[model samples]
Target: MNAPGHVLVVGASAAGLSTAEALRRKGFGGRLTLIGAEPEPPYDRPPLSKQVLSGAWEPTRAQLRTKEVLDALDAEFLLGDPAAALDVERRSVSTASGTTVSADAVVVATGITARTLPGQSGLRGVHVVRTVADSLALRSALLKARRVVVVGDGVLGAETAATARLMGLEVCVVGPQPAPMTGQLGPFVAGHLAALHTGNGVGLRTGVLLDALLSQDGAVTGVRLSDGEEVAADVVVAAIGCSPCTDWLAGSGLDLDDGVVCDAHCRAAEGVWAVGDVARWHHQGLGRLLRLENRTNATEQALAVAGNILGEDRPYLPVPYFWSDQFDVRLQVFGVPSAENTVEVVEGDPAEGRFVVRYDGPRGPVGVLGWRMPKQARLHRAGLVDHYTQPLEPTAP
Candidate 1:
């Protein structure tokens, strides 16, 4: 494959920026342009829910790179205009601001949009943390509110609940799982996290789904559960999952399932590639299509996509990884861990608050988890690496 003379990357966040940086490092001097929906420069979003919301770190601290470093990239950054439509054949993108960009290659890194409850749009005191403005608004609401009901028990909901509790507000988490992060961490480890949250004065109302958002006078009053329970609150945070940002790619004549479906090499079509949360690529090692939303995948996948664009011809197969920080605990997971997997403590003691656990499936160890034991967990992650590296067994017809 030959290097593209010009590459246009949509969604100028971590993935797009990393792709541009990777291209430069790989000795490609092609023309590069990054288009972003947000007006701000490329910034880190992981801290927006924690440090930025907690007021421990300023909003500017979430910037992924300093001005000097970004300037050094020597790429044209088209900020504040979101991609409205894509032309897969011509490899061009039309922005919402009426700007059309054409390139020899197009990279779709639009990422995902946070899910929100019904009637959450115009309502005051209801928040979802996806951008910097969202974090600031939620923080302001938290300071003025006495009670907050986080309507989800996933990672974002749990973290937001923890931060709210730390800020001296009464916090309660409502979700359909038995415990927080049950889907991500599995039941056994999520139970420990449940205890941690309860011990820290965070309320838990799991195993129930939200019926509706209760509001009064255009402000969120609380939320109603399907079980007919109405939890009172001055503010509400909806952290329910997210969907890929493929709305712009509609009618682009490219495959769009849950995301921009791509090949093993992250190529969507001829001279077209996809990266970050918006990419659902075939994992040759796993023998299936996979999409990851974590911060790590955003950058790592970008590097792979850049290499493939420059003719590396390598499949983008990686062991999925994600980490979360809540209260004082830092949980790290390598590979996927589901609630149905059987988990075993591999190192340290669970009672000591620092241990590593391994998740096993019918075949073998599939994931490794670190409960404040990052180094040990990383060492044990080698156990799951082979599962991704080894050739998968052929499926019977």
Candidate 2:
């Protein structure tokens, strides 16, 4: 394969920008264009849940790069208009603003959309924290909010709850998981998170299902649980989860499962590739299809896709990584840790609010977690490399 004459990236966030940067770094002098759904330039999202929401950092501080740096790329940026359709055979995309972009190669990096609860639309005081605007809207609502109910127990939910609590608002986290991030951190470690929230004056209402949004005069007043319990709230943040932004790619002749299904090389079609949260590609090392929603995966996978686009032909198998900051705790995770995997304390002690944990799967160490002990956890992360890189027996066709 040879480098294409022009590459069109279909999203203008971290992943899309990273791809364009990687392409130029690899000596690609071809035409490059990035299509963004939002009007603003690329910015970091992790801060939206913490620094931005908590008012510790201004919205401008979240920008990924300065204007001077972005201008150096020599790329055309089509912002404020979202991609509406894709012609896979022609390697072109149509935008919501009646503009069409064609290129020798098309990279899909549309990312994911935040999931909202039923009847949340057109309702006041309901918010999500996927973008900067969302964070600002949530912060505005929090200023007048006395009680906030966060609907989810994942990283986003816990972080939002912490932000709200620190803002002097009564906060309660509602979710089906037994503890915060139970699905990602396992029971042993998530227990500490539960304690952290409780110790911070954040209420925990787990192991329950949300039935409906209780509203009065078109403003959300509270959330009703499936077990006939209701939690009053002046503001609601639905951080349940997200789905891949593939609606525009519908009927585009590409495999679309949980995301844009791709090969080991991250190629979805003849001239099409995908990166970031919207890409569910075959991980050769893991012998399965994997899609990661974390920021680290967005940039790392984009670099791999860029190399492959420039004829490197490398498979994009990587050790998944992500981090979450709530209160004073910085939780870093390497590899995939599941609630099903058994956990063992590798270093430090949980009682001291600093420790490292190892997740053991059937084959061996699958993941390493760092709770306020980033250095120790990173050292232990070396043990997971062998398990992730080991060749596995292929399944019979």
Candidate 3:
């Protein structure tokens, strides 16, 4: 396929900005346009839950690039105007402002929207930190809140709870998982996290479902658990999860399965490609469609998509790495970790608050996790590529 003369990138966050910048870096001199639903320029999201929420850094410090840096790319940016529809056949995107932009190729990087608790709408002190505005609002609410209930046990939820605790709020984390981050880090590693939270005076409640948000006088007062118990709270932050922002691509003739389904090369259609959290592309290693929701994957996939747009047929195969910072512990993982996998301590000791752990699948060691031991984890991560490709041993039925 010939290189496109003009490229349109939808959703100007980390993935979208990286895609446009990569096209320029890769010598694509054609016209480039980036469309964003948010009014602000691309900014770092990881810090939103940490430094920014903790009042250690200003929101402006989270920007990925300054106006001067963004302008140097020479791309037309359409901010705050979200794409309302897509005409894949005509290779055009229509914004909510009644503007239609055409391009030879389109890159979808709309990313994900945070999931909220049911009946949370119009309730005061109920927040989800997905954007700068969200973090700002939640941070403001945290200052006045004495008892904060954080829903979900994922990275975002855990991080938020940790931040709230550091800010001296009586924080309670409620989730359905047996332990925090159990799905990603497995039970053994997650046990340490549970201890970390509880040790810091953060209440950890697991294996329970959230029944409903209790509000009185248009303000959130507590959360009712499935066990018929109400946990009182002055503020509630729902870090449940996120879904891809692909509502605009409903009738675009592209496959949408939780996310914009794409091939191994991140190509959704003939001239349409998907990147970032909104993309569910075939993972060559996993032999299945996987949608990653991390900053690393977003940037890496954006670069790969840019290469594919330039006629490179490289498959987007990654080790699937992620990290989280809670309290004084920095947890990092490389490759996939499953609860069923056999976990072993590779270095250090878990009791010491620093260690390198390896998760062995049927084939071999498929993942390495570091708790305050990043250098060692990185060294072990090199072995995951080989183990990921090795055929797994069949389990007895």
Candidate 4:
């Protein structure tokens, strides 16, 4: 495999597209092919649950509208076809159409798949908001839905519930965690979020697993709660989580625990590398290997991997960040905040639905998360570093 050889990219999300663009910018004129499972082109996914649900944005607008960019990059588009398997030994990828494309370097950007609940097989009004198709389906259902049962209170579930409430549908969220968004925001902030939703006419049930999807005549009617209870619903949306789309990498030598294991260079196993949601890449600066199921990470990791593929030596070390727009609140997060992490009120107030929480490591501020304060978060994003200390308040703007 040479520096400029046949480069096959699987998945057409942020990662794949960014990597292809980066490769071209790095002067790579290799045979490039980008494969996607969706019929639509690579689109921004954050709006699928919010603006698209409110009919403010259309599905067509979400696509990566840089056709000229891709054309100039000289990359072939293979939309709606998924990579079936990776023949790592032969350095080739097999597509669903039985087409095996031989390549010198392969970048897997297969993203993630939405996890569905048991007995939720029959779908008519039941939905998951991970893809454009899923959001479009749920938006149509919300037009007539009176109540919604959202299983899992992650950012996706919370956003869907908020959207349902905005659409005048009564919403209820059921999750196994004690508080909403605890996985990302921790207990203190999730408590405030839970309170916000419940106050806005949302029924939130924590620590309850989903039992079954109630259906009659092959159309979803309601949901049966795990603890012998039922939620009245015309729509049931499961926002449990996503599974890494590395099923095609099975038997490949790529280190796969939860996803394709890679270093900061995004090198997985042998001539193969992975990025985006399907990659668990090591960050040299952080001294830890982690995977981010975020658009920002997907873009950054893809570019960094592309640079490595083009013979650059820099390792990926980006500030992990993600955001959510729900109801009247705009949420932004930087770094991972666990339950044990010391949380301090860095700016604003939680009561006002605006605040920035700083997570302190043993040495100093390791991460910062905020809501409705883009300006502060922007400044704090640059301020945070390993062994960096942030005072309770900034030095006056």
Output the TM-score of candidate 2: 0.98
Off by over 4 Å in 2: 395-397
Instruction: Record all residue pairs in model 4 with backbone atoms less than 3 Å apart, i.e. clashing.
Output: none
226-268 in candidate 2: lDDT tens per residue?
8889999999999999999999999988999999999999999
lDDT of 1 by residue, 35-122 (tens): 9999999999999889999999999999999999999999999999999999888889999999999999999999999998988889
Cα TM-score per model: 0.99, 0.98, 0.97, 0.94
Give lDDT for model 3: 0.93
* Alpha-carbon lDDT, every model: 0.92, 0.94, 0.93, 0.83
Winner on TM-score between 1 and 3 is 1
Give the distance in Å from residue 109's predicted Cα in candidate 3 to where it truly belongs: 0.1
**Total clashes for model 4:** 0
Q: Per-residue alpha-carbon lDDT of model 4 for 1-397, expressed as tens digits? A: 3595789899898899888988888889878999998888789888888888778887778877667765777788888888998988788888898888888888999999999878777668878888898889889989987888899889999988998898898899999888888877888888888888988899998888888888888888887777878887888998999999988888776788788889767898677889899999777666667888988988888888898888786777777888887677787888766677888988999877788888877656677888798778767876565432222232355
**Which stretches of candidate 3 lie above 4 Å from their native place?**
388-397
Candidate 2, residue 64: CA error in Å? Answer: 0.2
* Residue-pair clashes per candidate: 0, 0, 0, 0
TM-score of 1: 0.99
Lowest lDDT 10-residue stretch of candidate 3? 386-395
Task: State residue 348's C-alpha deviation in candidate 1, in Å.
Answer: 0.9
TM-score of 3: 0.97
